[model samples]
Target chain A: MNDEIVLFDYWRSSASYRVRIALESLGLPYRRISVDLLAGEQRAPEHRARNPQGLVPALMIDGQTLTQSLAIIEYLSETRPQARFLPADALGRQRVRTLSCAIAMEIHAVCNTGVINHVLEITGGGEEVRVGWMKKFIGDGLAAVEALLDNPATGTFCHGQAPTMADFCLVPQVYNAERWGVDIADLSRVRRIAETCRALPAFQAARPETVKPA
Target chain B: MNDEIVLFDYWRSSASYRVRIALESLGLPYRRISVDLLAGEQRAPEHRARNPQGLVPALMIDGQTLTQSLAIIEYLSETRPQARFLPADALGRQRVRTLSCAIAMEIHAVCNTGVINHVLEITGGGEEVRVGWMKKFIGDGLAAVEALLDNPATGTFCHGQAPTMADFCLVPQVYNAERWGVDIADLSRVRRIAETCRALPAFQAARPETVKPA
Candidate 1:
């Protein structure tokens, strides 16, 4: 539909999947414009103009382009107030942002495509070393998340029963962890939250495999 | 002073500086506990129990130990509403978080002390290469922040005249940029913000030199 939003993304970008989850949760209609990372399409002049960092999950909203999954999700949540992705209280909101950043900053950045490649090339390490590093970082991060979720503060979701921005970030990071063969079973809290999230049609529809390119 | 909160930090840790800025902006009283990074004091069993990640900027809040600068600042803002470090509205809040992430996730993660050392040891890249990467990454990120701040939406600070959590994160990252000898003058908006932040006693008190070890 002409009214549909356009998401510029790659199939396996955990960041893009975050936005996908948000869009689906809000039940907003959207179209996907695949940018092949393997082909280095993200570095093309046009894409660079959109996102100088040459990253994915850029969204074209109301004729303006927005980069950064957190920003895009925040925009969507703000514009669609009825679909709240954050808590109403300031502390609650910070908890969600803090949890999200734990993954985005500490875990995801370490295991990101560029960083992983850089490590592998520099250390003369094979896939095993890289995978080992990925597992350690993601596993540590998830363990923290598990503790946060196990707190009396946690409900059905990261914050409460409803999925907040934190959940949007968590699911995709877990997806990447799975791809790396990291065991999620040990992370009982994260596993429970992920399962609850996957059960939701919104989260299901936004999965990497559900996207057109896959 | 007995009732003063304690902040466990490293003099050079950008994450710790972020909390310092927030505390300064909010005019909160706290004592600093220095953990020497070069001395490997952060890995000490005592410190590890306070923070499993062995990271700095852990806050002792309301009898609970809190790690992560974003989380500490948010908790501070929440507990001290009058010192509101984030915007009241979701859109404004999202913009702040987005800017913060640009520094925390994109810039800080890439140039982290750990990553830089890894690059040196693994890539056999001399200090020149390591420092080059740091400058390039931080410089580019500051430029992005400059663009975000240039919008008429920006007031005296990153978000507005009154410093928010975003400004707290921005100032220290700028400090790190300066340490790298990057010509911050080129990024006018960032220079302006850093100048504005430094003028405040809160920020000054939170400077690395102001910490106990220094």
Candidate 2:
């Protein structure tokens, strides 16, 4: 139990879901501490002290606290080399990192809860406009991901038969898209990969619904 | 030279600046190929062929194309282990990645060129509003980064005395923040790191003004 890991997360956070998937995939044992974003729990003093940014998915590992989903996922990969989440080669690793960043940095950030709220506040746009923006960006991003996955270079997962960091990122983004009523069926390549990932117990267990708050 | 690296970039892109700094720091032989973002050169079929995302800072390495500034930097670090852009240990590596993602995902994307344009179009808000949003997000992000740097763990750079991937991200972001007329000096930690980094020739060569099309 001394090796215990704790994840401070919000169930619906795509970022949190990404880290959850990575932890499950690595089969690491972790305790979950839910921070309710909708209720402003993340902004509370205690949570802010834990993470100065007032963000969820902060991980406590090896007696140190870390924030940011990509950071946490990369840390897990580094500490647990036997369950490497990135490719061993330089180019192969870059491809995986590129895909992950495309979603994490480009797609997810654009549709984030805060951004959506800001857009609504500024434009007086209703849910429709907000959802429209979300759909447009997510669809475009997923198309890019699909293009990469469709490459002959791709196999069972994002990079190859084995799961890499890209797979962890893809599943959560797909889940978020579904919430916005964005149809991903046309993205055959992405759909196939998500289905394959869903069949895995690790990915299954990490679904947002599986978390405590849900 | 056979090992020449050609960077497809734009002068004002924060993402592009990141790769330039990494390449310059590694002391690698590389040439800049400007893709004018303001002129829509990035959307041309020729440029899109290199990066389907039609974004700047695509690295052509040994004939393969690498997109995403973070990905390109990671590739440089992996391929040239001797340069040591990341730390040798797993924990230290995670910290670096976490810091890098904080800026890339949180700050850079929020104030991205495309998003800023979109906000301007929708809100009918002029440069003041747009620049206001940019300063708020970038300033808040730098403050978080400053807190991270305040830890005893920090050295001359973001992580330690040697510049790492986090420094690559920080320099470009600070550049953008300054361009918007944000007073970075208020965030003393970030200012100090930026000052230390600016002293390096690598960072100087990577400045937006140094890129073609300036």
Candidate 3:
């Protein structure tokens, strides 16, 4: 198992983008295998075998196939403790996880491509409806993120002057929100964290524009 | 904080339900305050202060309020090592979190009541449409759960003979699936895990019927 680290992810997947940042932040090198989500490569039998949900960014590391971005990040942070991807105490860790999950569950998962497509199919609404649905969920979720950021525990990033799992989840969602044209200028706290994180080469290297498959 | 543990949750909120089972499994006693989601009580100013997300199952323990079911469980499992709610090693922990997240993110979060209501409003579909959507998402998500359970790592519970966080998540989603009338007979692996976990008094005590407010 010679320390194999392979990431099977789509270039534009916000979930995949999170893992890329983790890997780069930790300075771990790995091979990249693009799964062309828009082309339905994720639905192929081989990919389904890799991840039962057929979702992008499944990483094969240390002879194990790991699914779920947060879980994968946890594994990386645990295995590479120096990365400091999590907080030290239980309370700090809980706060970071809560922030990360607020975005992951409350927004990203709820407004994901699959769910949006389902909404469109059932409603027979086209792109306009899909964009509207995206705006509403993203807006409400970001507002909650702003509130969470107001806590004194927050610093230069989602936690105390360092990027943890919360920032990994937060940055990608912020990117998606901007892509949807949701104005985030009102979210000063969230904007500050995203801006601070984006300044890092690790985050910059993981951008969808930088990683997009040819 | 005098070892006080209070859970603010609604009877039928699956996110809240997961926390109840964790507390019970750990033999921790806590007072329950129902948030009355049906009456929009979760939106009250007080609840918002506790958890800005205004969601249920915010546990106040050790002088801090914790939101996000998974985060709370992680805190419990970390603080009380004796509870063993998670696996021992990094790989095992990742696997358990993956299974738990498959339900939390892939199904429960995606098919939430709010999301469903939004779908109805945008699609102009009524109860039938809502039910259809639930069945589809729940069924698909459960099928993935079933596949994840097929691994040799699974025991009577989601991880081993002893229950882990995976079981805590599985039981509630199973309850929700049944509530939505999604058939699970075909998912023997999932059914077996759910049945095994249900036999525990902790799971039984946390059922919506048992915990509903008077």
Candidate 4:
């Protein structure tokens, strides 16, 4: 019940990567507990005690455990407005949420390990098939996001001059999309935003390469 | 650019159902412009102009277009405080969001029509395979939700006295679950809340049955 912030996370996980960026961006000090998804450690009894959903990026703060990456990032955003994790106006907030959901709800969730593995088992598809499946959805998801980004509202980041929650979702998804061999050559707008976000120290330190287990 | 609220939605789309329930519960007068998903209306150029994501429950209000169901719902929860669409406290809001994301982010997003269709084409699977894929995720998702619902926080609904966004997601998913032949006979907690929400007039009118295309 201590007030110290702690994040249950896996380095390679887009969800975990998201919370890392949010925390790092907010300059919030939090401890990290790695839940190795490939090792099936997220299903551990102790982890289950923290998150009923058995998912990564469960943030513990204010003596309470919070699950779901977007929710956790949102908790950070609402609590730490100095970071401007979300925009100030309602319409701006709505736009940021829309963009965030485009990646979190539409893309990353669909391409989750559990869902892809389920697809593998149901179809008896091999690894190549699975990779192909990931690439197709990742490509389409980014395409939709790219179109949305093709607006005057879109600046160096997903929204305006400053990075927001939408950028937190965007950076990790772009990283993971490339890892899956999805061709992003056509997604000009997305690539520009990804480049902008990755340059910042907060985003750099949270990259999968930096946080990956030794 | 008008102040009138217009929802471009598709009946039988759980995402659309979630928004419909939100609008109905808030007693917001909005016009429905159905985007026939099965008929490929969402891909139409005009619809794409409104929502580059080509997804439904796109709300045009306050002279701006908003996409993503969860985002739209959160806007309603924020701006329409009289309905108490969300909890008052931060911790309470986090838990409510945790439950809401369990369904929106975990289950519904993974089992999206486009993703499922892609699975079918890539795996060379038929309708049975598709149904099986859905039931597995739906069952697991509900099980996770049930565990969350088991805590002392549970009242007559997913949050407390009034139905929140969690129930907004759960009811449509349950309706879709039943439609897809996913048995909920064992998911007692989820079924209980679904029943409670279904009995309400707001949820009743938003049921896919009422909104289904003739």
Best by TM-score: 3
**DockQ: which candidate is best?**
3
Best model number under lDDT? 3
Order of all candidates by DockQ, from best down to worst? 3, 4, 2, 1
**lDDT score, candidate 1, position A163:** 95
Query: In model 1 chain B, which range of ten residues has the least summed lDDT?
Result: B114-123
RMSD of 3: 1.0
How much lDDT does each candidate structure score?
0.80, 0.85, 0.90, 0.87
Model 3 TM-score, 2 decimals: 0.98
Tens digit per residue, CA lDDT, model 1, B1-214: 2456888988889999888888777777788888888888877889877775666767886767777787677778778867788888766776787777778888887787766765676567787877777777788778867766766668888897788888888888988998888867878888888899888998898888777462
Local accuracy of candidate 2 as per-residue lDDT tens digits, B121-171: 878899788988887788878888877777776888889879999999998
Measured against the true structure, the TM-scores of the candidates, in listed sequence, are: 0.86, 0.96, 0.98, 0.97
Q: How well is each residue in A1-214 modelled by candidate 1, as lDDT tens digits? A: 2455889999899999999999888887888899998898987888877775678978877666677898788778778867798888766776787778777887887677777766676578897878777877788777767765666768888888899999999999889889888887888878888889999999999998888462
The sequence of per-residue lDDT tens digits that candidate 4 reaches over residues B75-119 is 887787666767887777877888988999899998888878887
Those runs of model 4 whose alpha carbons end farther than 4 Å from true positions after fitting are none
Query: Tens digit of lDDT per residue, candidate 3, span B1-214?
Result: 5677889999999999899999889888899988988898988999999999988889999999899999999999999867888888999999999998899998999888778878888777799988898899999999999988889999988898899999999999999899989999999988988998898999999899998766
Q: Listing candidates in order, what is each one's chain A TM-score?
A: 0.94, 0.95, 0.98, 0.97
Clash count for candidate 1 is 0
- Record all residue pairs in model 3 with backbone atoms less than 3 Å apart, i.e. clashing: none
Pairs clashing in candidate 4? none
